[model samples]
Target: MIRLAILGSTGSIGESALEVVRRHPDRFRVTALSANRRIAALAAQVREFSPAVAVIADDGVGGVPDSGGATHWARGRSALVELAGRDDVDVVVNALVGAAGLGPTLLALETGKRLALANKESLVAGGSLVLAAARRGGGELIPVDSEHSAILQCMRGSGARDVARLILTASGGPFRGWSREELWDVQPSQALRHPTWDMGSKITIDSATLANKALEVIEGHFLFGIEYERIEAVVHPQSIVHSFVEFVDGSLLAQVGDPNMELPILYALTYPGRAEDGALRTFDPVASSPLTFEKVDHGAFPLYGLGTGAGARGGLAPAAFNAANEVAVEAFLGEKIRFPEMAEVVARALETAPATEPGGVKEVFEADREARRVAREVSEQLQREGSSRKG
Candidate 1:
C-alpha cells in the first residue's frame, strides 16, 4: 500500500483525496494529515484516517483530540515540513493553498518522496527550485490539477521533440462574456458560483478573473518544459475537455472527462498503474453536450496577460505575480476592493516590485514578501482613491 501524507486536509482537494483513499482502502493508507486553521475538521479527519501524524497551523490551540492517544500531533509550519519529509511517507500530497505549500513541496522532493502536487503556487513561486530539488532527490513530481494531469496523460507515448504545442482549456468562468463595466461590481458570491467544477472560494475567484489560467500556464512551462509562446489557453464552456496537446504532425490529442477532482487525485496516487474503479465517471460522447472553444479576451481579463507575462520574464517575476495575486484575492474577498481592482493590484505590484534571481527558497520567500507588501500598498491606495471619488 502507498503511504500518503495529505497536506491541507481540510480543503477541497484534500477532502477529495481523502475520499479516494476511502474508496481504495486496500491500495493506499493515510499516514499524515495537515490543516491551516480548521482544527475541528482536522480532528475529524484524524479520527477517520488515524494517521501517524496530524499538524495544525494554529498555535495555542489543541489540534485534533488524540482519540485513544494513538495519533501523533504537531503544530506550525515547521511541523508541516517535518511531516512531509518523514521517511515512512511514500507519497506526499501537497494540497495546501497559496505559498504555504511551497516549503513542504521542497521538503517532500528533497526526501525523495513522490509529490502529488495540487498547489500551483508552489511552481508559480519557485519552479526552478522545486524542479532542481526533484532532480537532486530523485523523486517523482506528479501534477494533481486536472489540466496538467490531462496533458500528462496525452503526452504519454510522445517524445518532447515530437510535441508541437499544448492547449489548456478554461471554463471561461461565470464572467466569461462579461464586459469590464459589467464585472466592475461583481460580488464574491457571484464569482464563487463556478459552473464547471466544485472548487474552493479562492480558486473560484481566480477562475472568474482568469488568473487561475495564468498560473496554470506558468505551471505547464515547468511541468512539461514547454515554451510560453507554444502554450495556449482557450475558453471551453462545456468543461468536458480538461486539456489538449497538438503534435508536430498536426494531430491533436485530448483528455476528456467529467470535471471531477477525484479523477486527477486518483490518477496521481496510482500513476503508471490503472485501477478498474467504478466510482470514476465514464465519458459518453453522445450524452455530453457539444464542445466549443474561443479565443481568450485579454481585454476582459487582464490578469491573464499580467501573470503570463511575469512568468515569461522568469526569475522572481512569477513569484511576485503569485504573491501579489494572493493578497489581491484576499482583499477582494474581504470586500476591501472592487472585483476588478484585484487585477489592478496585481498589475501595480508587478510594475513596482523588483525582479530578482531566486537562488533558493529563502530568496523566493523574500520576493514573495516584497510583492505582497507592494500589492497591499497598491490596494490601500486604490481604496483611498475610491473613497475620495465617492466623497
Candidate 2:
C-alpha cells in the first residue's frame, strides 16, 4: 500500500483525495491527516480513515474525542510539517491553503517523500526553495492541480525543449462579462458563486478576479521549468479542457474531463498507473455541451497582469504579490473594501514592497509578512478616501 499523509484533510481537495482513497483501499492507506480548525470534520475523517495520527491547528484545549483511542493527536501548525516528514509516509499531499502550506511542502521534500502538491501558494511564494529541497532530498514532486496535471499528462513522452507553450484554461468565473462599474460594488456572496467549479471561498474569489489563473501561471513556470513568456491563459467556459500543451512541431494536446477534482486527485495518488473505477465521471463529448473559448480581457481583470508580472520578475515579487492578494481578498470578503479595490490593494503592495532574492523559506515568510502589511495599509487608505468622497 502507498502510505499517505494528507494535510488539510477537511478542505475540498483533501476531501476529494479521501474519496479516491476510499475507492482504492488496496492501493492507498491514510497514515496521517490534518485540518486547520474544523475539529468535527477532522474527527469524522480520523474515525473513518483510522489514520495513525491526526493534527489540528487550534490549541489542544478542547481535545478531540477518543474515537477508538487508537490515533495519536497533535495540535498547532508545527505538527503539520512534523507529521508530513515522518518515515512512514511514502507520499505527502500538501493541500493546505495559502502560505501556511509552505512549511509542510518543504518538509515533505526535505524528507525525500513524494509530494502531491495541491497548494499553489507554496510554489508562488517559495518555488526556488521548495525545488532545491526536492533536489537535495531526492524526492519527486507531482502537481495535483488540474491544469498542471493536464500539462504533465500531455508532456509524458515529449521533451521539454520541443515544447512551444503551455495553455491554461479558465472558467471565466461569475464576473466573466462584468464591466468595471459593475464590479465596483460586487459583494462577497456574488463573488463566491463560481460558475464552473466548487472551490474554497478564497480560491473562488481569486477565480472571479482571474488572479487564480495568474498564480497558476507562476506555478506552471516553477513546476514545468517553463518561462513566463511561453505561458498563456484563455477563457474556456466549458471547463472540460483542463489545459493544453503545444509543441514546436505545431501539435497540440489537451486533457479533457468533467470539471471534477477527483480525477486529478486520483491521478496524483496513483501516478504512472491508471485506476479502473466508476467513481469518477466519464467525459462524453456527444452528451456534453459545445466547447467554447475566448480571449482573456486583462483590462477587466488587472490583478492577472500584476500577478504574472511579479512572477516574471522572479525573486520575492511573486511572494509579495500572493501575500498582498491574500490580504486584499480577505478585506474584500469582510466588506472592508470594495470588490474593485482588491486589485488596487495588491498593486500598491507590489509597488511599495522591496524585491529581494529569497534565500530560503525564512526569507519568503518575511516577504509575505511585509506584503500583507502593505496591502492592509493600502486597503485602509482606499477605504478612507472613499469615505471622504462620500462625506
Candidate 3:
C-alpha cells in the first residue's frame, strides 16, 4: 500500500482526496491527516481513516483532544512539517492553502518523499527554492491541479526540448465577459459562484479574477521548467480541454476530460501508473459539445497580467504577487475593497517589493511577509478612498 500524509485534510481538495482514498483503501493508506482550524471535521476524518497521526495547524482550535483511539493528535504548524519529513509516509499530499504550504512542501521534497502538490503558493512563492529542494533530495513533485496534471499527462513521453508550448484553459470565471465597470459592482457572492468545479472561497475568487491562471502559469514554469513565453492560457468556458501542449514539430495535443478534481487527485496518488475507479472514469465528448475559447480581456481582469508580469520578473516578484493577492483576496471577500481594486493593490505592493532574488527559503518568507504588509496598507487605503467617495 502507498502510505499517505494528507495536509489540509478538511479543505475542498482534501475532502476529494479523502474520497479517493475511500474508494481505494487497498491502494493507499492514510498515515497522517491535518487541518488548519476545522477541528470537528478533522476529528471525523480521524475516526473514519484512523490515521496514525492527526494534526490541527491552528493553535486556537480550543479544548483538548479526545483520547482512546489508535490515532495520536498533534497541534500547531510545526507538526505539519514533521509529518511531511517523516520516514513513515511515502506520499505527502500538500493540499494546504496559501503560502503556509511552502514550508511543508520544501520539507517533503527535501526528505525524498513524493509530494502531491495542490498548493500553488508553494511554487508561486518559492519556485527556485522548491526546485532546489526536489533536486537536493531526489523527491518527486507531482501537481494535483487539473490543469498542471493534464499538462503532465500530455507531455508524459515527450522531452522538454520536444515540447514547444503549453496552453492552459480557464473557465473565464463568473464574470467571463463582464466589463470593467460591471466588475466594480460585482459582489463576493457572485464571484464565489463559479461556472464549473467547486473550490475554496479564496481559489474561487482567484478563478473569478483570472489570477488563478497567473499562479498556474508560474507553477507550470517551475514544475515543467518551461519559460513564461512558452506557457499561455485561454478563456475556455467549457473547461473540457484541461490543457494543450504543442511540440516543436507544430503538433498540438490536448487532454480532454470533465472538470473533476478527483481525477487529478487520483492521478497524483498513483503516478506513472493507473488505478481502476469507475466513478472517476465518467467522461463524454459527445454530450459536452461546442467547446469554445476566447482571448482574455486584460481590462476587466488585470490581476492576470499583474501576476504573470511578476512571474516574468523572477526572483521574489512572484512571491510578492502571491502574497499581495492573498491579502487583497481576503480584503475583497471582507468587502473592504472593491473587486477592481485587487489589481491596484497587487501593483502597489509590487512597487515596494524588494528587487533582489531570494537567497533561500528564509528570504522567500521574508519577501512574503513584507509584501503582505504593503498589500494590507494598499487595501486599507482603498477602503478609505471608497468611504471618501460616498462622503
If ranked by TM-score, best first, what sequence of candidates would result? 3, 1, 2
Q: What residue runs in model 3 are displaced by over 4 Å at the alpha carbon?
A: none
lDDT of 2 by residue, 1-391 (tens): 9999999999999999898899999999999999988989999998899899999876754866654577988888787779879999999998888999898888889899999999999889998998999999988899999999999999998877889999999999999988888898799999999988998888999999999999999999999998999999999988999999999999999999899998988888788788887967687998767999999988889999999999988999999999999999999998889988999999989986556778777889989999999999999998888889889
lDDT of 2 at 23: 90
Clashes of each: 0, 0, 0
Tens-digit per-residue lDDT, 21-103, candidate 3? 99998999999999988889999899899999998888886864865579988888898779999898999999899999999
Clashing residue pairs in candidate 2 are none
In terms of lDDT, which candidate is strongest? Answer: 3
User: Candidate 1's residue-wise lDDT over 1-391, tens digit each?
Assistant: 9999999989999999999999999999999999988898988898899999888876667535654576888788799878889988999998989998898899899889999999999989999999999999988899999999999999998766778999999999999998999998899989999998899888999999999999999999999999999999999999999999999999999999988999989999888777767988677888787879999989989999999999889999999999999999999898889988999999988986556678888889988998999999999988898889889
Candidate 3 weakest lDDT stretch, 10 residues: 60-69
- Cα distance off (Å), candidate 3, residue 68: 3.4
- Candidate 2: segments with Cα more than 4 A from true spot: 60-63, 66-68, 388-391
Candidate 2: minimum summed lDDT over ten consecutive residues — where? 59-68
Which scores higher on lDDT, 2 or 3?
3
Of the pair 1 and 3, which is ahead by TM-score? 3
**Worst ten-residue run, lDDT, model 1?**
59-68
lDDT (C-alpha) at residue 367 in model 3: 94
Q: RMSD in Å for candidate 1, one decimal? A: 1.3
